[model samples]
Target: MAVHHPATIVPTKLELLQAWVPHQPWLGGADVSTVTRLGSYRFDDPDGEVGMETHLLSTDDGRVLQVPLTYRGAPRVGAEGSLITTMTHTTLGNRWIYDGCHDPVYVTALVRAILTGGRHADLYAATDGGLVLEPATTHVRGSGSWSSADVPALTAPVVSHHGTTTTIHAGVRLTLPRVLVATTPAADASLSGTWPGQETPVVLATVDGSS
Candidate 1:
């Protein structure tokens, strides 16, 4: 589960995206003003060191894009190339943002989610009275192994395919779709889900280990 602290963040998520989105190779020349968030989901870090989030956005032309992000208390070592931006949080202080593809926490959690049929992490909002369940805008379901404990951490560099897929080279190859589609290719393991107004199950990612 994910817990949200009642803290303020400078340059909100959308604000940061506005400045960084246009620099992406796959979204070259795209206008950030027209981008709209469709929904989002979260995954918990077993170690509780980082925040993992995935946002689904739609471009003005109707292209659906998936953006996975990781939040950290400090800058991620050797991840300069993947840095999205740095911002300050009212309670947490400075935070470094990176593309989730380059973060081991995110990679491992994603693998575990797919390999264990994990569902979206439940969210809780910190309030004066107590914690309250926050309704998630997106829902996710996975299919594969049952235990995430056996999954090892990713040690090698993650590979990107045309910005549409992210591949982690661990003991077994894991791939996550960066673009949403009505139909997706099958795999040894996979994740699918729906969002508000979209009832059909859309493939979110796949995993393959046959070599």
Candidate 2:
């Protein structure tokens, strides 16, 4: 489950994304003002140290983008290049945000979820009384593992940007589609999800890993 604190963030998520997304090489020079958030999903950090979230956005010109982000209490040691922006949370104090692709915690959770047939993390709002379930706006699922052993670590992912796909090499290869499509080609493993207006599941990412 993911718990959301009812606190104010100095630079809201959208605000930070606006200032950051345009600089991405794959964005085709689209600015933040033309971006619209379609939906999002979350993954839980078993250790409860990092906040993992993925947002699906669309450009005015009809290009879909998948952005995964991780929020941590302190700076991620060697991820200076992936830092999005820092923000002050009224209740939690400070938060350091980074592109999830470069964060091991996020990469592990994603790989584990795909290998274990895990679903998106359920969300809850922290209220004065207690935690209240927040209806998930998106639904996601992954193909489970074929073995019982723990998922292996992928030291440092080497990323390659293509026109419509972003490939990451870290022992295993992960392909994330930059353009969200209704129908997906066959893949070795995959993560898929559905949103409110879109009843059909959209392929989020595909994995090619050795057994």
Candidate 3:
């Protein structure tokens, strides 16, 4: 389960995205000001050190963009290029934000989810009463089933972005589409999701063994 705090955060997620999205080459000249959050899902870090969340956004031009982010107490080694910005959380203090594609922890979670039939982390609100379960607006599931014998092992990963897709080369290749599309190629392992209006499951990420 993923516990969330109601504390205030400086330079809110929207503000940070507004500043960062306009510069990305994959946006195809879409207006950043019109960007709005459509839905989001989270992946739990077993060690509970990092906050992993993937945001789904929509623009006035009818583009749905996927942006995965990770929040950590300290900067990730060798991921300076992926740093989006730093922010202060009223409860958690300072946070270092990075694009999830370049963060090993996030990559591991994605790979594990794809290989182990994982689902979006369940959400809970940290309240004075207690941890209260919250209904998830976005849903996701992996196509593969857990198999202790077929565990995925991710080593040093090389990440690159091409057009609207990002690729990560490690023990397995992970392909993530920055822009949501209705159709995607079948892969050895894949994660698919459905949002409010889009009941059809769309492939969000895929993984295949290294050749």
TM-score of each: 0.90, 0.92, 0.95
Which candidate do you rate higher for lDDT, 1 or 3? Answer: 3
lDDT of 2 by residue, 1-211 (tens): 9999999998988778777777787675544466778888999998999999998887777666788999999998878988999999998999999988878888777777777778899999999899999998889888766553666667676677887677877777788876677878645578888886788888888777742
lDDT of 1 by residue, 1-211 (tens): 7988888798788777766766665553344556777888899987888999998887777767778889999888888988998988998899999988778888778878888989889999988999899988799888877776765555654665665566666656767666677777555588888887678888888776631
Model 2, backbone clash pairs (residues 3+ apart or across chains), number: 2
For residues 16-109, what per-residue lDDT tens digits would candidate 3 score against the true structure? 8878887876765666676889899999998999999999999888888999999999988878899999999999999999988888889988
lDDT of each: 0.78, 0.82, 0.88
Clashes of 1: 1
- Global local distance difference test of model 1: 0.78
| lDDT score for candidate 3 against the true structure | 0.88
